[model samples]
Target chain A: MERLMKIDRRLLYLISVALVAVTIFMPLGLPVKVSPLAVQTYDAIQNLPDNSVVLIAPMYDPGAAGELNPMLKAMLYQCMERGYKIILGNTNWTLGVAIAHDMITPIAAEFNYVYGTDYIEFGSKPGGSVWMQSAQTDLAGAAIVDFNNDPIGQFPLIQAVPRLTQEYIAAVLVLDCGTPGAVEWLQIITQGTSIKLIVGEIQMSVPDSMTYVQSGQYNGMIAGSRGGAEYEQLVGRPGAALKSQDTMSVIALMVALFIVLGNIGYVTRKR
Target chain B: MMWLLAQEQAPVPTLGIFSAGSVIDFAIVLGLGVIIWVMVARARTGRKIPEIKKIAGLEAVDEAIGRATEMGRPVVFIPGILSVDNPQTLAAFGMVSHIARQCARYDTRFLALNCDPLPYAVIEEITRQAYLEEGRPDAFNPDDIRFLSAEQFAFTGAVIGIFERERPAANIMIGAFYAEAMMLAETGSFQGMIQIGGTAMTAQLPFFVAACDYSLIGEEIYAASAYLSKEPVMYGTVVAQDWLKIVLALIIVVGAVLATVSPDSTVLRDILGGY
Candidate 1:
C-alpha cells in the first residue's frame, strides 16, 4: 500500500501521454478571441484588390512549421479566395523548399489556382538577404530557376511578370521564424520601397515585433499561434490556429495549477 | 455570426467556443493531465526530489543585487517589453518575482523597465509579491518598476537612458525579444554591466550567445519556471518535456527509416503529409 502510495513516475508519464493524445484527438473545444494584430493582417489581405501580387517568404523549416504552416495556410486561403498572386520563395535550404512545396502547393491546387498566373515558387535563393535585396532590383535576373530548378525564362509566369523592381509586387510578407529575418526587411530593403511588410513571428519574438507594429513600420504582423488563430477568425475561417488554442489553454491551466499545487505540496511536506 | 465563426465541422459535435479544438488540443490537455497525475503521485509518495542546478542567470540575480549594493547603483531588470499575455513574458514575470525578492534581501535598489502597459502593472504586483514573500513587503519600491514606451526600439532607447542615468551594476533580460535584442544587449555590454540574458528565440539565441556571458538557449527559457520553483509539479513538467523529446526522437527515427526504405509507402507518406 505504501509503495502504491509512492508515486509511480511511469504511470504518471503514461497518464499524461494518454491524456494529451486523447485531448488532441477529442473535441474539447477552447474559446478563441481574435487579437488586434491578427485582425489587421487579415483585413489587409482581404481588402487587397483581386489579382494583386502578394509575396510570401517562407523563412523557417519544419521545426517552426507547427506555427508558420497554419498561418501560411490561412493566408494562402485568403489570397486564393481573393485571387491574389502569390510569389513563394525562401532563403533556407531544402527544408524550406520542401515545406513550401509540400504545404502550400496542395492548398493552392485545391483553390483551383493556376501556377504562373496565380503563384510561382522561386525555390531557395542562392544567398539569404543579399538575394532578397537583389530580387527587389531584378526579379528575373536574380531568380534564374523556379522552385523545380527549371529555367525562370522557360516559365511564362517568370518571363511575363514585370520586373519585381518596378513595384508591381503588392505586399511583402516575411514569415520570419528566425533572426536576420524581419529585421533585415525592416532595416534594409523596405526602407523606401512601396512594398508593405507583414511579419509573422513566433510567440517568443512578439515583444520586439510588437514594437515595430506600434511604431507603424510594419503594415501588419502576426504573433505566433495565438495570433494565427485570431487571424483565422478575422478571415472568417477557424482553422488549426483556433484548434491549437485548446492546447494552449490546457497547457496554461496545467502550468498555473502546477505552480499552485507545488507550493501547497512544498509547504505541507516541510511542515 | 459569432456562432457561425465558432462552428466545428466533421469530426466534433461540440460548438467551437474559441476555435481551439483540434488534435493538438487533445495533446495539450493530455500533457496537462499527465503533469497533474505526476504531481499527485509525488505528493502521495512523499518522495522529495533534489534541488535542481541553480541557473547561473537566475543565481546572478543576487550577485547582481550585491554588486548594485556595493556600487550603490540600482539593479535594472527588464521583464521584456512584451505583455503578460505572452508566455515568454510571463516567464520573465516569474523571474522578476525572484529578482525582486533578491533585491529586497540585499537592500539593493531595483528598476523594471517595461514597454507593454499591461505587463508593467503585473510586474509591479510581482515586485510587491516578491517583497511580501521575502518578509520585506515594506521594502517594495513601486517607483523602480516603470513602464517605458510600447514601441520596440523606443523601449530599447528607454532602457539605454535608464542605464546612463542610474548606471546599474547588472542588467538582466529575460523573455520574448526580437530585433531590439542586439540594441539592448549591446548597450548593456558597452556599459560593462554583468549582463545575463535568456530567451526561447532560437534565431536571436546567437546574438545573446555572442554578447552575454550566460545565455539560456531554447528549452531552458521555458524551464525557468520549473527551475525557479523547484516544485515537484514543475519538475514533473520538465520530466514530461524530456519524455516528449524522446518520443519525438523515436518518431523521427522511425519516420526517417520508413521514408528511407519504402520512399513511396502510403503509411510513411501519410505520416509526413498532414491535413
Candidate 2:
C-alpha cells in the first residue's frame, strides 16, 4: 500500500496514453446506448417534409471540431437519406467551412445529390447575429458567393430559398460551440415562427442548452459526443464516435481504479 | 356587408412613433433610468446612502498587491479575450483602472495582457492615466501591456508561458471568459499565486471558484468598481440596480401566480415578452 502511494505520476500518465492508443488501433465492439434526446433529434430530422430545404450551420472552429464534426456528419447522412435539399453554411466561423465541406462533398456524391439544385455550400460569412438577421430578409445579399466564390445566383438552391423564412426553409440545424451560435439562431431567425431550430451542442454546454429544449425553443438537440454516437446509430451510419465509446469506457474505469487506489493508500498510511 | 365595405373605404389610422407592443418595455426602461437619475442627484446633494455589503474578492485586491510588492514580483491582470464591445469587458475596464492606480501608488510592476487589439489600446491608455494620476508616470512601462493573440487557445498558451516565465505573485482575471478560464486559473494556482477572478460567464464561474483564492460571482463584478472607488454617485447607480432587482423579483412572483391561476391568461406573458 505504501509503495502504491508512492507510484510515479508519469507512470500513470503513460498507462492512460497506452490504453487510449491501443483502443484506437484494436477493435472493441462496445454497444452504444442511445439517449432519449438523441432519439428526439433523429426523429425531428427524419420527420421533415420530403424535398424541403434545411440549413446546416456549423457554428464552431477547430477547437470544438472533435465533438461537433461527428454530429454534423450524422445529420448530413440523415438529411440526405430523407432527400431534403441542403444549404451548408455559417457566420463568423471560417474554419468550419473547410471541416464541413470535406465531410459534405463526399457524402453528397454518394447520394448522387446535385451541387446546385439538391445542395449548396455558402461556406462562411462575416458578421455574427447581424449576418443571421440579414439572411432572414435577403440570403443572397448576405451571401453573395458560394464556397467556390461563384455567384450565388447561379445556384438553383439559392434561387429556390431566397431568404431564411418558413415559406422557404423548413428547419435550421446548428452545431453550436459559443456566442452567435444556436442562441442567436433562435433569437434572430426562428423565434415566433414555424421554422424549426435543431442544435448539436458540446458536452460542457449541454446543461445550458437544456432550457431551450424544455421550453420548445429548440425543436431538438444532439447533446454531445455521446449524443453523436447514439445519433449515428439511429441514422444507421455508425462511425468514429461509436468506436470512441470503447476507449472512453476503458478510460473511465482506469480513472475510477486510480481514485480507489489513492484512497486506500491514504487510509493505510494514516493507520 | 355594408359596415365592412364602409370600414374598408375609410382610411386606416397610422401607428404612433412608439409601437404598441413595445410600450411596456419602453416604460420599464424609462422608469429605471429616472430612478437612477433621482438617486444620483440625491447622493450628489450630500444625502446619506445605504452601506454596500462587502465583496471578499474585491477587498482582497489590496492584500494581493501588497504581497506582490513585498515579494518584489510583478502583478498580472487579464481583462479577458474579448473586444471592448462586451458589457462585461467595459465593467472590467473600471476594475482595471482601480487596480492600476493601486499598483502605481505602491510602486509595483503591473502587466496587462489582452487578446483583442481594441481593448489592448484602451487598457494601455487606462494604465498610463492611472500611473500619471498617481504621480508615477515614469513607472508605467509600454512593454508590459501586450496584445497576445486573437485565437482563444493560442492566447491561453501564451498566457501560460507568461505565468511560467514571469512567475507573478498575483493573478487578477476579471471579464468575460470561456474555455480557457480553467487553464489560466489552474496554472496560477500551480505557481502559488494569489488569484482573484471575476466574470459574468456562469459556465466558467465554477472553475474559478475551484481554483482561485477568491472569486466574484455574477453581478458582483459589476459592483466592484463602485465599492472600490467609494464614489457616492456610483453608489446611487448600484442602489438603483438593487431596487430594480427587487421589482423584477416581485414581477416574477406575480407572473408565476397568475400563470398558475389561469393558464389561458396571456396578460403577464404579453407584457413581459414585450411583443
Interface RMSD of each: 17.0, 14.2
Give a tens-digit lDDT track for model 1, residues B152-224: 7778888888888888988888888876788788788879888778887655777788677678776676677
Let me know the DockQ for model 2: 0.16
Which residue pairs show collisions in model 2? none
Best by DockQ: 2
Candidate 1 error regions (>4 Å): A1-271, B1-21, B40-58, B231-233, B266-275
TM-scores of the candidates are 0.50, 0.89
Residue B256's lDDT within candidate 2 is: 86
Best by lDDT: 2
Residue A240 alpha-carbon offset, candidate 1, angstroms: 37
User: In angstroms, how far off is B144's CA in candidate 2?
Assistant: 0.8
